[model samples]
Target chain A: MCSMKVVVCVKQIPDPAGNLRLDQASHNLVREGKLILDESDSYGVEMGLQLAEQAGGGEVTLVSMAPNSETSGLRTALAMGAANAILVSDPALGGTDALGTAKILAAAIKRAEPDLILAATESSDGYTGTVPVQVAELLGLPSVTFSKKVTVAGDKVIVERQTELGYDEVEVGLPALVTVTAGVVEPRYPSFKGIMAAKSKPVEELSVADLGLDTSEVGTAGSRQQVVSVVPAEARSAGEIVTDDGEGFQHILAYLERIKVI
Target chain B: MTLNVIWVVVDRTGDKVATVSLELLSKARQLATTVEAVTWGDPSQIAEVVGAHGAQTMHSVGDLGGGLPGPAVGAAIADQVRSGSSPDAIFIPQTYNGRDIAGRLSARLDRPVLTNIVDVEESGSGLITEHAIFGGTEVLRASFTAAGPGLFVIRAKSFAAEPGTDGAATTDNWNVPDLASTGAAKIISSHVEESEGPKLDEAPVVVSGGRGLGDAASYQLIENVAKLLKGAAGASRAIVDAGWVPYSHQVGQTGKTVKPTVYIACGISGATQHMVGMKNSKNIIAINKDQEAPIFSIADLGIVGDVKKVLPQLIEALEKRN
Candidate 1:
């Protein structure tokens, strides 16, 4: 019923549609060239903005931990009407696992002091799906994840938490954390005017030290898990290829019979 | 020399256990001296089922009266570990609520969770987890360096479910600790999406569509073919993210993993994300306009043609035969 301050965690990942490479030496993803907002996080940004708007008047802040102070992705969310952004970038943060990232985010989000924090259920790049909950725990807040639908009512936030078979309508108090599944909402494209306005938006930059996190607690050293090895998935060799060739359907039928699918 | 592992079973309806629970139990038995289970349901009802799948002790936390039981369950497990019954590791199936409990428990125990694990094997002094990252392009191996009670959230269908000779398990009532915030998030209502025919993961035959279906309306062709074959309809992450299909129908890394007898992909240039989910199917048939589509690589049979043209023919031929 009142103004609600929201924070959304966004990620700048290599475009999922493009080719991705791995740093063979470090056994990490090679982050290079242009980085864009992860498609999955767009829903979180949209949800945060909408929740803020519904509360009559509020601000949606973006928080991210990325390499090279990636603002391109945050700008896209800012263009969609977020008030501002906070990016914590450092080379020391490289090779950090999900838990380390959560520690950094938890500290940054605490500074924002939002009524709610929203994040994607998982990142398209890491696909860890653990940081949001970890952040909630670190802040001593309740969290509901895999929310397909979310609504703010009075002091409680209600969500339709997605499950394997269906969904459960869960209600949590304000200042809680929620990780949304994709398709929760249709993310709006930045209008020309909105894009122009985003250029003037404030983006606060911070380092791991600024968050009061020791360098040892926020990077590969702080990571609880170690990547023992990185190997390309066994390539599935090409199988029998058939052109339309008039008899293609019959060939498929015979193949189906061989597999006993019929 | 022996490891004690606890497997958390998600039993929402109080009747049936999730398939992934049994799958984890099967794998847990191999890596642990004792495979204990925790569930939020009547222990008597699920004891035999879990025991048949290798669980030795069942810690049951009966229904939480329409509340999300994550915090309560996590607290109960933490209490067990704190009271000198700490297990070597805790394995949880990667589900909505499972992550919630794992996160809460990890924070309570001050340990980190290794999530999205697709495979696990016994390693030197511990277990190693295999993660498929970057849309399943790379496989990374990791293990915990911490002490006991390493938490893991495992993916579905990662291991085969097998029944053990034991037909019953010793059950104990787990007392849920009263917490100020455990009751904060309450489940007012729940609904299962109305699906016709068989479920996607259990369906013997699955017909899936992707972005190449062009628009949402064209998705009907995928359904029609699936209907003709008495199979379930599925979709790739591309189509699901595009809002063409519900998340329940999505078959990929972030979605449900289906190992159907036959998986037919239409208009899908399978990304590694989509392939990992259904690549384990007994037979894969991919139909896409592009010959070099990644889907064709894993497909037992590949049709390099327009799906709009080919799907109609396949349906018509199946109808005639029927």
Candidate 2:
């Protein structure tokens, strides 16, 4: 068995391209219906699988916290070749902010005892972009964010972290946390055999108590920030629509000139 | 009661400050009674610019070598808070390093971080922040319930950078604490992605392509039009994920957020993910065959036609004028 153990954090979010509904009473996303693995987390899962493969022989474990004991998203990651999954589901997790979510994930990660941790830079739904770093901090491990490329050597992990202009080559020792950006790798589709195997793949379920987290500290009661109000963005007034009758390009040119962009 | 706010500055190559840092400094000045600028590297390099941007004091953490010094920088700032010089709030850019620092600081202080904020305003001696959610379809206003030291990681171009007439800022050295585990992560080497044209985020004009272009070869139409207009070429997340273009060209919620003067969308259906990046552009022009495409919802000028035909005609029109 390979000594390298990796834990990848995956999230289940409402399909961005689908029609979404919100809970009227609490003003929260209605996440109980038809949730799938977030597209953003696919890159991290792919990176984890690739790194595990590169390490000669290792297992890729997935960790997630969703409402209603959702195993569909975790199973999807397992179908992509993860060895096992751990899900933290409880009503107390409802309305938990990014920091609270991080605390729970950090505790679960400690139980997995992986040498490396991988996560997406941001979630499709929440998009907080702070949880991975928060997990790293809570676990007291070195962390790197926005990695476009990652490779593992004997006891050291090297990554090309994306910067505003380009990328910086960063090297970190084992037991480090890294967040991957989208398009970092081409995610693979699960095969028939892999899908079949995923059904039997070990999925360990835990709750706030199992993770040694207090309900008061893991839910809305523990949230530091509160949404005061939410409003729809100002609808963009429809503009001129020109049919392409040979003068279409001319109209565009004139518009650009009017805006002084040409 | 005067509020003390700290704004983190990111230094670009050749010692210039990032535009987002200056923007934060400008906004922070208006929100707080005193705005202090924190940065790594030599203080003299950015002291004048930061001061002009409304910073009264400049805190320098010296240098922590080549690789990113996120842990060390965060530790230094946390030390300042622990020493009883705690500021009421701290603002950090949404860059990679900025997020790292914010995360580390939040962990150290056991505080919550309000991230991806686009606006902030003072309310009753505290601050309220606004964030775009659901791919910019809705806006949410949030505030801290507990006392702060509220930490925020703000997006670029959310607020325009305006320099004030303030004089040079007073400089002070901050003692960077020893990093126990964070020191292990070091930079081996660095490489900048090679591109000949203007950057997507900085370009005044941007021409972006989407999956509707059909194939990779058709993407050249976008590049050609961008070159003719002296703009930069961009891509939708769909095309970028499909490997039709580099990730640097992606413009969306997950990609670079651009607010160019003029943005041209070619055959893009304008998914919420893609619209979030360029919705703030001064003028948006979309060319797609689909009349019901969402791109037209926010576009200033919409052309209902095939991109394959319209792009060439538009290119010819520009060429003839030149």
lDDT of 2 by residue, B1-322 (tens): 2465655555454357888888898888877778888888888877899899999999888877864757877889999999988888899888777888888888888888898899988788788899887667788888899885899888888998998888988999899887778656887777777886788888999999998899999999999999999999999988988889977898987788899999999999998888878898989999989999999989999999888888889899888878
Every candidate's chain B TM-score: 0.94, 0.94
lDDT (Cα, 0-100) at B97 in candidate 2: 79
Clashing pairs in 2: none
Top DockQ prediction, candidate number: 2
Predicted complex 1: CAPRI docking category: medium
i-RMSD of all predictions: 2.0, 1.6
Q: Write the per-residue lDDT of candidate 1 for residues B139-250, one digit (tens) a residue.
A: 8898887677789899888999999789888998888887676447778887877799998998999999998889999999999989988899999987887888889999
DockQ of all candidates, in order? Answer: 0.66, 0.73
